[model samples]
Target chain A: MSDASQGASALTPEVKGIIGATAEKIEASFPWGIEREGLRIFTQAIMDPDPRYWDDEFAAKTKFGGIITPPIYCTYIGRRTRPGADDPITRAFEENPYSDGIQGVRTPETRGGLPNIPTPLVRTLNAGNEIEVRQYPKLGDRIFSQAKYADIKERVGKDGSRMLIVTTETVYTNQNDEVLCILRASSIRR
Target chain B: MTTAQELRDKKQTWWDDVDVGHEFPPLVIGPLTSTHLFRWSAAIENWHRIHYDQSFAVYHEGLPSVLGQGSWKQSILPRYLKDLCLPDGWPWKVSFQHRAMIVPGDTLTIWAKVTKKYQEEGLGFLDLDVGMRHYAETCPGRATIVLPIRNGKPIPYPFVPPKKLSEQTS
Candidate 1:
C-alpha cells in the first residue's frame, strides 16, 4: 500500500505534461492489432464458466461452428503492451504515475487494463456494461482492435460536486477487419 | 382440508409461498479449466496473463488458479435470477460486492430470499437479498432485484409537450 502511495505523489508537473502530450499523439493511432496468444492468455485469466470454451465436441454442437469466445474478451485485445511503447495495458501499469488503484488518481495508461485510454486525474468505475454478440472468435484467430477517446463530459451528481466522465470506445475486428464487437466504457474523475 | 382442496389452494407465484427462511434453489456451475478461460479470452479479446498462465497468477497474485472476472459473475446473476423468477420477471436494479474469490471447479450455491415487497409509482417491487456461497464461505457480492408484480401493467412515461403551455394556449 505504501508503495502505491509513493507512486501517486511522484507525478510531477513535467511528467503530467509529457503524458498529456503523449495522449494526443497516441490518439491518432486509432486501431491496433492483438496477437492470438495474448488473447488466449486473458480469457484464461478471467476464468469463464461455459463448457463450450473447454469441450471441443460441445462447442461444435453450438451454432458458433466451433468454440466461441466470451463477450468481455475485447477488453484485452490489441492494446499497447509497453510505455512510450504501444501496448495499452502494459503502459498503464508500468508508466503513468499516480496510478494507485484509486479512481481519478490513475491515468488510463496506468490502469493496466486493455482497451483503456490514457487520461490523467480520473478514477475508472464500471458505470455499466452492455454486450451485443454478432459472432464469437474461433480458436487461433488474430484479433485487431481500434480504440478512440469517445467522450468526456462534466456533470453534477445529486450531491452537487462536478464530476468528469470520460468514455473510451474500442471496436474489435478480426484479421480481415471484420467487426466483432464494440466496447464503450466510461470512467469518472473528480 | 381434503387433498384435492389443498392442491387447488397451493400458490403458483414464488412470492406467495416462498418464506423468508427458505433457501434459494441450488445451481451447480462448472469445473473451470484453461480451455474455458482461453475461449472466454479469445471471445473478449483479453490478453491478461493472470487468467491463463497459472504459474504467473499463483506466483504473482498468490492465487490458487486464475480468478474469475467480476464481469462474468455479473452476467451469471441474470441467469440465476431468471431460474427463480418467471420469464417476464426483470430485476430493476442489481448491486453486488465481491466478497471472496471464485475459481474454476468451485461449486457455488447461489441463494436468495424475498426480504420485502412494496408498491412504488404504482409498481409492485420485491426487494431480495441474494448471495453465493462456496464451501461454506460467502463472497462479498450481494444483489438486490426489483420484480414487477404479476398481472400489473407497467407505468408509461408522461408525454412532454414540444412547446410551452402558454405558447400553445396563445
Candidate 2:
C-alpha cells in the first residue's frame, strides 16, 4: 500500500467522528496561579534574562507596575501542582522518572491538541500559529486554557498526496475571566 | 511613583525615531541541546519523545535528529521583541509560520525589520518582518507592535489594541 492510500483509508469512520470535537480540558499551567519560581525557570530555560521577569523593583517602575511573564509563557505554564498520593500516574512517575515515563506524563492534549483521534497518518508537523495577546500574564495570575477544533479539512498535495489540516483555537484566560490571548494553531498530518 | 519620563529616558527609541526600513538588533539563542529541549518540555509537562529521544525520533519517526517544538521557537520571539521595545512600549500582535523545521544544536538568530510605521488612536504602530535563521532560514513571520511617542502617554499595560485600526491595519 502506498503512502497516499494508507493515509486515506486510515481515516476510519471512528476517527472521522472526532472532527469538530472539543479537546479535553487542559490548563496550560498548574491551577495554583503562575508562580515566581516557575517563571524564573522558564526565563532561564529559554535563555531570557529580562529583568522585567524577575526584578520586582525595576518592574514596579515599569508601566505594568509588577513583574510580568513573557507574552507566550502561558503556553508552558502547566506544571504538576502538589501531586496527590492517590493519583497512580503521578505517583508512579514520581517514584521512578524513567518508569513508563512517556506514558505517565503524556496527556491526550499533548499530541496535536486532540488526543488519540484515530488517523493512519504517521507524520505530523506543526504548521504554525497566529497569536493575539490582550494582556501579558503576571506572576500569581491563574492561567487556564480551553481548545476546540475550529476546522478540519483534507487536501491533496501537488504530488497527489493526501493530508489532514487540523486547526485548533485555544483561548487562555485568567481566574478573573479576563482573556490573555488566543492561539490559532494548525498542524499538518500526512 | 516613577514618572513615564524616567522610563522614556531609560530606553530612547520613540515613534519619531523609527523609519520604515529600520532593523532592531538581532537576538541569537541556542546551539541548543537535548538538555535545553528536556528542560523546556519538563517545564510544560510535555512528554513528547521526538523532542528528547534520539532513537525514537531518528529510527522510528524517520527524523534527522530530535526536533524542536514549535512552541519553543514561538516563545523565544517575544523575548527578542520585548527587549527591543523596552522602557516605553509593548509588542501588541504577532503572526508567524513554521516554514521549516529546526533540529537541536542549531543556533537560531532572530531578526526583525520594520516594513512600515504609522500612528493610530495615539499609539505608534510598527509593522515588522521577522524570522529565525541558522544555517538556513527556518521560521519566517510578521509582527505589529504599538509604541509610545516621546512625550506621549506610555503604552497602557494589560495592552488594549487600538479600537480603531483603520489607519494601521494591513
DockQ for each numbered candidate? 0.07, 0.42
Give candidate 1's TM-score. Answer: 0.44
lDDT of 2 by residue, A102-144 (tens): 5655443453356555666768887778777778798889888
Steric clash count of candidate 2:
3
lDDT of 1 by residue, B1-170 (tens): 11223222323343444544556655556665666665664454355666666776788668888866555555455445534443233333334555566776776666676676655554544556666677654433333333445566532211111234213211
lDDT of 1 at A11: 34
Model 2: residues >4 Å from true position, as ranges? Answer: A1-28, A79-82, A85-104, A109-125, A149-166, B1-10, B59-62, B164-170
Q: Please state the error at residue B65 of candidate 1 in Å.
A: 2.4
What does the lDDT read for residue A175 in candidate 1?
57
Report residue B55 deviation for candidate 2 (angstroms).
Answer: 4.3
Give the local distance difference test score of model 2: 0.74
Error of 2 at A31 (Å): 3.5
TM-score on 0 to 1 scale for chain A of candidate 2: 0.72
Which model scores highest in DockQ?
A: 2
Worst 10 residues of 1 chain A by lDDT: A20-29
